[model samples]
Target: MAQQVRGVIARAKGEPVRIETITVPDPGPGEAVVKVQACGVCHTDLHYREGGINDEFPFLLGHEAAGVVESVGDGVSEVAPGDFVILNWRAVCGQCRACRRGRSQYCFNTHNARQKMTLADGTELAPALGIGAFAEKTLVAAGQCTKVDPAASPAAAGLLGCGVMAGLGAAINTGGVTRGDSVAVIGCGGVGNAAVVGARLAGAAKIIAVDIDDRKLETARGLGATHSVNSRSTDPVEAVRELTGGFGADVVIDAVGRPETYEQAFYARDLAGTVVLVGVPTPEMRLDLPLLDVFGRGGALKSSWYGDCLPARDFPMLIDLYRQGRLDLDAFVTETIALDEVEKAFERMHHGDVLRSVVVF
Candidate 1:
């Protein structure tokens, strides 16, 4: 049976999202229906509303989410009813070449529900990142659900489905910040601060946070930054070098995803050091760096996709850390809002007034 439930959707480009009655169909083969408990208002959701991702209109927003499995379709064994799970956009297909090589994080093929979710008038919705979770209930591929500790707060645990995981993995997995390494994170947004936390967890000797906003810098320091740089007032590359014995940081992460910030990251790392780009950029955005600089750097320049995370391997471990008080997932949540308040939350996010405004069901 199809169930009609309240959901938030961007009916058209540049329009405010509104609560609408959406039809969620029962799970089919290899699919499962999730009873959403919490979903975060991510910048990507805003991007969807603005039609930045693609021409996929009427997007069902919200991807960073946590929920409980309500039902499973035939042949679904990865999750069962009543299982607490975090929804992930990347549901690795084991048969992909990357998965066959044991690097499922780079799996070329991912999974989504076979059936389409639709509006009351029967207009099919394009789900944000293939997981339309900003609803009371959503249907997803069984592999999209990563079971984790049920005791973890749904609001905090849900974040691991996206931004937080991206940041942490940017530092730990992509940049390879190890013990005693000096790391500088350019951009003190949620993802940047998570890089700081990841650096600290990796035992970084000095974690330098660079951002235009003083408030975000302060937040980064509290999270784990050993030093802070106001990039607006100072040359970030020079400041980072001065903070690291004039050799720059061992690793530099660009979380803002702008050409200027990326340039700063390029010049702010030590020669033979790594540079990781985790920020999302627009399609028209381009980078014009000197080819000599790229060759002379003598280290890796990597782009992190979903923090290069393998959900099956990372989510449960991170959730456990969150439960043990090692990881402060709660700090990322600035406030909680109802589903109807999503448009208002977007305004707050645009103005940088909150780190995250999660929708609690």
Candidate 2:
């Protein structure tokens, strides 16, 4: 039987999301239904509302979420009903070439619910990141649900589903931040601060945070940044170099995902250091660097997709760390609002006043 649930939806391009009665089908093969407990308001959700992601109208928004599985479909074993899990966008296909070669993090084909969710009148809805979660209940691939400690707060744990994971992965997995390394993260939003936290966890000697917002920089400091640079008043590359003994950081992460921030990350790394781009850039944004300079820079340039994280491995461990009070997951949750306030949360997120506004159901 199909279930009717209240959900936030973008009915048309650049339209405000509205609360609608969405029809969720019973899970099909390899799928499960999750009763969302908490969902974080992420910029990506707003991007979807603005039609920045694609021409997919009537998108079921929200991805960063944690919930309990209510039901499972045939052939689903990874997650069973009553399990507490964090929803992940990347449900790796083990048969893909990336998985066959032992690099499932780069899974060429990810999984999503085979069944389609729709409006009461039968308008098909596209779920954000294949796990539309800004609703009371959502359907997703069984693999998309990563089991975690049930004791953790849903608001905090759900963040691990997206931005937090992306930031930490940018530092630890993609940038390869290590003990005694000097790292600089550009853009101290949720992702940038996460990089700071990850660098600290990895024992980085110096973590420089660069951002135009003072409030975000202050938050970054609390997350373990050794120094904060306001790019609006300072040249971030030069500031980072100055903070790193006139050389440059061992790793520079571009969490802002803009061309200017990308350029700053490029020039702020040590000659042989790594530059990790963890930010999501728009389609029209271009990077024009001197070809000779690109050749002159002796470093690896990489992009992080979903922080290059393996959900099963990273989620539980991070939750355990949070449980131990070693990682500050609570720091990311600035405010908890209701589902109806998601649009307002997006405003706060855009204004840079809040790191995260989570919806508690």
lDDT of 2 by residue, 1-361 (tens): 8899999998887777899999999999999999999999999999999889997889999999999999999998888899999999999999999999999999999989999999999999999999999999999999999999999999999999999999999999998899999999999999989999999999999999999999899999999999999999999999999998899999999998999888899999999899999989999999998988788988899999988999999999999999999999999999999989988888888899998999999
How many clashes does the backbone of model 1 have? 0
TM-score of each: 0.99, 0.99
- The TM-score of candidate 1 is 0.99
Candidate 1 lDDT, 212-275, residue by residue in tens: 9999999999999999999889999999999999998999999999999999999999999999
Residue 190 displacement in candidate 2 (angstroms): 0.7
Candidate 2 clash pair list: none
Cα RMSD of all models vs. native, in order, equals: 0.6, 0.7
Error of 2 at 183 (Å): 0.5
Model 1: how far residue 128 lies from native, Å:
0.6
What lDDT score goes with residue 223 in model 1?
97
